[model samples]
Target: MSLLAARDLAVARGGLRAVEGVSFTLDAGQALILRGPNGIGKTTLLRTLAGLQAPVAGEVAGDDIAYAGHADGLKPALTVAENLHFWSAIFGGPPIDAALSAMNLTELARRPAHALSAGQKRRLGLARLIVTGRKVWLLDEPTVSLDAASVALFADMLRGHLGQGGAALIATHIELGLDAQVLDLTPYRATIRPPTSRPAGFNEAFA
Candidate 1:
């Protein structure tokens, strides 16, 4: 069975429908990339799948999903190791040693999150996926702020995840050199329509 599946999914942005009629399935040991121009609702779609927001229509099935968005989601006062440990505890995941090593964070284990560079912080955020112990990953622009070498490191980690029977749905512009399928959101773009009610302050422009 697919680890995660979306059927006739319709997601909105800034209170307006952005993409619709989307359907896809991700299975063990597989990865799928979301492709489209900006303002096409890639982030909005991911947010919907991650359960951060509700979809306008259709359905998303399956669970055990971990989502990493543009924000690092780190606590500035915490050290790298502490952040990983905290996430692991919350997710009932494995120890931090492996995740630290995978993200090349072993050397910065003791450094506070606020002290790290942007790329380092991004890596730390991505590392949380390792500790989540979830079977499916939904990532949006995960490579942002990552240097080329760091991007390679992330690609290796993603490969490891899939090789171990985990699945991923990623929205990224750069190529990660992974053997994965691509799902273009262009054809799913919604036409102009009256605005729909969204959360009090949500805006798709920044999503």
Candidate 2:
């Protein structure tokens, strides 16, 4: 059976459609990688599938999904172990020890989340998903700050998850050494409208 399925889905941001007529299905032990350049609605689609946003059109069918967005959702004051424990209580899945060991975070288990480097924090965030025991993972740029070694660790963890009948939908620009069906989102890019009334020099203001 399919773990997650989207049928002719349409997603929008700020009242403008960003992904239209998109459909796909993910089954157990399967991974789907969403590929596209910036501003192509990859994040928007992931958010919609994660149930963080309502689709402009169509339907998404799934349950027990863990969503890790661009931000590593961690408490600055909480220790790495504590953070995973918190999520475990809410989602009722694996043990904290298993999760920590899966991401190779046992050494930093007692350290405050704020003190960890970018890669450590990302690992902690990924560990939270493992603790939840959810069957599906919705990841957006999960490898953002991870180095080569950390990326390899993450790939191993993902493989273990799939081995246990879990599925994943990932949005990333770089390859993570996983066997996944590639979804080039370029063909689904929405025709975004230009800003209506910005100052002439506003484009370069943030540059």
Q: Pick the candidate with the highest TM-score.
A: 1
Instruction: Report clash pairs, candidate 2.
Output: none
Worst 10 residues of 1 by lDDT: 198-207
lDDT of 1 by residue, 88-155 (tens): 99999999999999999999999999999999999999999999999999999999999999999999
Local accuracy of candidate 2 as per-residue lDDT tens digits, 11-44: 8877677778899999999999999889888988
Model-by-model lDDT, in order? Answer: 0.94, 0.89
lDDT of 1: 0.94
Give the backbone clash total of model 2.
0
What TM-score, over all chains together, does every model reach? Answer: 0.93, 0.91
CA lDDT of 39 in candidate 2? Answer: 88
lDDT for predicted candidate 2 compared with the true structure: 0.89
